[model samples]
Target chain A: MKISHAICLSAALATAPGLAFAQDFEAALKARQGQFRIMALNLGVLGGMAKGEVAYDAALAELAAENLETISELHQAPLWPEGSDNMAIDGTRALPSIWDDRADFLAKWDAFGKAAEQLEEVADEGQSALGPAVGAVGKACGACHDAHRQPSS
Target chain B: MTGGQRLSSDDLSAAAGDGDAAAAEQVFWAAGCASCHAAPEAEGDALLTLAGGQRFPSDFGTFVAPNISTDQQVGIGGWSFEDFATALRNGVSPQGRHYYPAFPYPSYAHMTDADIADLWAFMRTLPADQTPSAGHELSFPFSIRRSVAVWKWMNLDDEFVLGAADTESLARGRYLVEALSHCAECHTPRNAFGGLVKGRWMGGAPNPSGKGSIPNITPGALDWSATDIAYYLGTGFTPDYDSAGGHMARVVQNLARLPDGDRQAIAAYLKALPPVAPLDGGG
Candidate 1:
């Protein structure tokens, strides 16, 4: 009876780690991927307006605005889940320093979230605000990257 | 993780002793410049060949690296020997414009004059196909290089050479680390104007390379020994399972080809230099 119980305990312990592993890094990657997709699609909507390639559709514009807000809200959270090792999810490249300096890394994310939120508010206002919205969004991209991104070759 | 991570600083005891131009070229090639610059076709995450196009995504936005090949119409082909030396020594271009230190001129500046000559000769020998190197797409104050000069004047001294009190080996290391290599430009943090924030030397910078952070590499890396540091420079791996990824692989490749004596000198120089907190942008 003792042996059977020990085996059961050991087996249970072995499976425990597997359960935690179920939290796929892919989920994080796909979320960022989704951000890029939606951001690009929204840009397409804006570009269409600029080029007069498509007639201004209020409904389409509304969708783009919604996407902008969603992305902005998402940006407020950490690009990488706390304790993550993946670089791509963070919308950055590979450099061991990201993991090496935790405080600075987190601070960069915090700054980015603030800028993203501001841009989202502007972007959600509609086509009339595209100029400022683009600038705000661009600024957010720059703010996160300047301090945290790796060097150019 | 620590055991295999760093390469032995002394392992390259067999490095070719001849520091001639040929040897210099050999080091340059071994350093993996071709991996990003010389490829006939651009690939991977890199944006350009030697005509640099690698985009460094930073808090400021994505800054693309410039092509530095000897493309006469488009690259450094027009550069004279002095032009090259000035760029390396001062982190300025032939046109006297301040380079963003993205060229690794800080570390590259530490290379021996002879090695610089060799590199120049080799670069001059590359295909001179002009691919227009564009201006940095920076915002406000950063878009201008003159302002960069003001920043340069504040952050860097006239020239931070090795002190006479340092040993010959230490001097060599300083020369390589500061001038030829300019490792500090990135490995060292900056003040608001982009100068090497005083009191904070090479505790590792926020890796301006558009990738991962470059970590605080003082004795701060508790697991690393002096020998371990040397080995990692020689090999791409560190003592802890971390290998030299990103642009640092090129650094290891360069060190691997350098004379064993020179590599040790570099390590000693690093050890002796005063330590400082690079990015003290307190959270």
Candidate 2:
């Protein structure tokens, strides 16, 4: 009976609404941030090449663009479960509007994906083509950020 | 000039003639009309439509951007050049009522008659939206329209904050930052009366919307090279590859449309500024 009581106590703790949700979303938030860091790293490489800050290499540009395209296509739904917004969670800049305006958010995600695909297709062609492609991707990033993310103080 | 004063009849006659639309297009972009007048979240060509329902919340009240589109019935399309000039430079409406400073005419008040006329001409060319203007929501005393004249009397001036520009680029940058872009409107801190604290020129301020603080662009605070500043202005990308977010993204969209040299000029001007620390740092 003591062992059964201990088991029930553990189960109750695990199912507690506030504690459980916070623990679950902490991991999701970390993963989401990690994914964005990776994207930024690859985007930096492509951006450097386009800006001529780094020598243009057809192979390197292709690799960076492909990485971005792959990441953009990932199914990120699980990472953005409800109640994980900045209003409910600290240290995250994802505003509550992302959940309130889910349709618009998803559309922006799709637009970013399309822009990444276009960037990948033309990245290896030449630096001239890469310039505009990178700009389009940058604009797509800004569009969503303007609507969904909080500004850095 | 007193509040509610219209342009003189001579000035009105001068502005009545056809303005140089080509030149005005530059003024349109420089003045950043679309940043507030365009529909919120608008992108690309849609930004040119001055439908104006964006709401700005402040300590006093929520100020709604009114429709400045060329719609004859709902917008300023039917207003004479004198009316438009007065509104832009004098902070008075066509109805002889004083306008709130949220419209940023305090900066535009320094605009030359030629630039104002040109801006009017360029505005006339844009597509008109049928949307009606929205009234501002304000608290008492502040809600009283007549109270603005007192605020105007205390704060309004056409003086340039910086001394004479030694170089042509510096001159251009001063015009853009001071009169056209009105960068200080956000970057400079304000007193309890909402007047800009001229002593702390480019020092950062509490974001009037109460979200975050606007950064200090003085040389002491922003250490980015001129090229970095210009590049960031054009592409919205920082040196670290982090993109500009929030309202600055819209600012980038407008600046990108300008000639490359204009961005460089702005960079040069910023670099030449005396460094002023942010107020929170005990400035």
Candidate 3:
């Protein structure tokens, strides 16, 4: 019985790393997608105001901008583990170049962070100020997306 | 003015004089010269450098954009007005070689002589980079330069796809799309021979990179309002707030420089297109 128990323990130990890796892949993909979803939600609020699709409320705009800024500041490295690219997994729009060209990728993230900070500063200023700020943030988003993300399906 | 004919100095004499640099700037943006010629990820004034080393990979091969900057040694600076016009209108280089269709001279073939002259003048004013052009890495017969003449013979035509633009805006939009912008080059599906499938006009294709598919922008596929489309062109934001990704971001950068009315005209033209079904699960 002890030998059987030892055998079972060894088997579980052998599979543990592979199982953990699968979980990590799924978790990382979900985390990154969740972050993008949150960013999109907040951007939608600002975009609506900029386009006059919705009435501009200083409070709402400020809140959305702050949310974007806060989210952009998160330690996103954990959500972009090396093998979590679309080539390695399904349901991800993240391209392999994100890993292959990591320095440029990180630089784009920094740009988006700067743009978000700028948006947070000027979002409540007025509709005119908000429009350009929102545009800057959008461009920053695109600057990264253009080179990194897969096209929308 | 044929597909493989080189323009003579006499043929270009009418346009040899100074072109309107101001108007030419508009043509530059419309032609999206910087989209391929500019170094990857170049922005701001760096976009004006036009150093040209972007790589476009397709089934045929990888085509590297040539340096069109004013560097006399490696770029087109030494080429005459006739050389420039012939390359644009006839898909032939000054060296008496046929240029591959990947340059999109097929669409440029429809460009008016004045626009070509204006574009040339604007390009002359830009900064020069001395980067030597990398040749295309094509497969088999495609590697042969002479083979391009056959491809050009089969595919080169200047006919506009849209029959008539009832409105002035539509006419302008048609010119921008069918001639200057070469939107169909990416959005339209291509055949086995790499010729555009005109029947699938604006029907998105599998990306030449073989990653994601290009979206079909025809009226059937794109549900965005004209305002939304124009806004997306200007700001790179979709109606749902998702930003333009991939090569479209570069296109947005170019289109955004145009007047709002131009973006709206493009949107109007897109809306006017017959809804082509997405190319069989491609988009």
Candidate 4:
């Protein structure tokens, strides 16, 4: 019983509470996390494929590529999870500058998301493309994390 | 120098005093200053910024390189020679404030007394600093002076020294790359408390500037020829002909000016390091 892209997209549409045009950030952040998780998985699976390093290579690659496409779609659709707990953890590799500079982080994230989409273009070519594709993804991760995410000191 | 043998303090002072410039020179050579702060070619375009570069990036943020030249106003012109030595030996400023370990004072503290003096002697002769030093913008707990002193007292040593070297070339290389150049502090990623994760030596992290990842240079040699690595350090162009960009551009410029042998030796040592596990592996 393979769930098709139509069904997955439909699931996203139907699950939303309403206000299709509404920027209900809480829902958007939830949605975006889902997307990044999928994208991360996409890179992982493709990396695995490049090395021929795992079982179920074809299946994993297919699922990963598919997720990569969806993740790219949802990029920038979520940020700053609304109504989220503010229990801030200390000793964060995160610098105080980020909170002070939200606009810059968002702008960089937007650019990062766009570059991430290019990964799908390379990835769609097939597993042989993964090693370089991952490099592209690594660049995006670095660019954003440099501006936003704290290094795990 | 490893195997727990350090020159006696008196031997080092005596070497400098007795005008045995060779022993004094050996100490200076071992400390790794010529690795970066080179004497200007008499071409009249003296390279005034004898310090490593205009800026260095770390887990915290980017720090600008200070002018090491003996120039009085712009550089440490007002200081006694001993003041300069204390900065290197104890990671303190000429003003007696904490010198951040970002200067690699953690490893440099291992330098012996005589070696430090010679290095200072060498620094005094540098093209004097025209580059004004940038003050750091550290956060609250970090900005405090006493805490830095405590960090120095505990985590840093004041002795001019290094961890014992084993193989001679390897020892020489380590002295240059690690202690003197403070390569590991940047090239290696840090743990949560901002300490170098030793096992991952030279495994680069995203520079604190939030610009780009300095590619892991431990396994970095495999991606290029030894000459290519040396050449890039010397000239900024990889063998691929692609120029290294961003913050590394400055580092390459500094490296390019170094003595040829120093560049080659550093490359050889970096190439020989064990490849650490990559952190970005997909699940």
* Candidate chain B TM-scores, in order: 0.74, 0.94, 0.95, 0.71
Q: In model 2, how large is the Cα lDDT of residue B244?
A: 89
Instruction: Estimate the Cα RMSD of every predicted model relative to the unseen true structure.
Output: 22.1, 4.9, 5.0, 13.7
Best by DockQ: 3
Q: DockQ of every model listed?
A: 0.02, 0.59, 0.61, 0.02
lDDT of each: 0.54, 0.85, 0.86, 0.54
Per-residue CA lDDT of candidate 4, range A121-151, in tens? 6655666666555544544444455344543
lDDT tens string, model 2, B145-179? 99898899988886888887899999888888888
Backbone-clash count (model 1): 52
Model 4 chain A: ten consecutive residues of lowest lDDT: A82-91
Off by more than 4 A, model 2: A1-21, A125-128, B1-3, B12-23, B281-283
For residues B8-127, could you state the per-residue lDDT of candidate 4 as single tens digits? Answer: 343344222433444455445444443334332111134434543445445555555555667777667677655655666666666667666666767775555656666665555556
TM-scores of the candidates are 0.54, 0.89, 0.89, 0.51
What C-alpha lDDT does candidate 1 achieve relative to the native structure?
0.54
Model 1 spans with C-alpha error above 4 angstroms: A1-153, B1-19, B26-49, B91-96, B104-115, B161-165, B209-212, B275-283
Ten consecutive residues with minimal summed lDDT in candidate 1 chain A? A83-92
Local accuracy of candidate 1 as per-residue lDDT tens digits, B1-283:
1111222224222222324656666546533455445433243223124776556655544566666776767777776666666666567665556777555554554456556666666666555545666566777767666775665555445456445525788776776677655566656676665666546566766655443467665544323555656655664434432335446654565566566576677678766666544344421
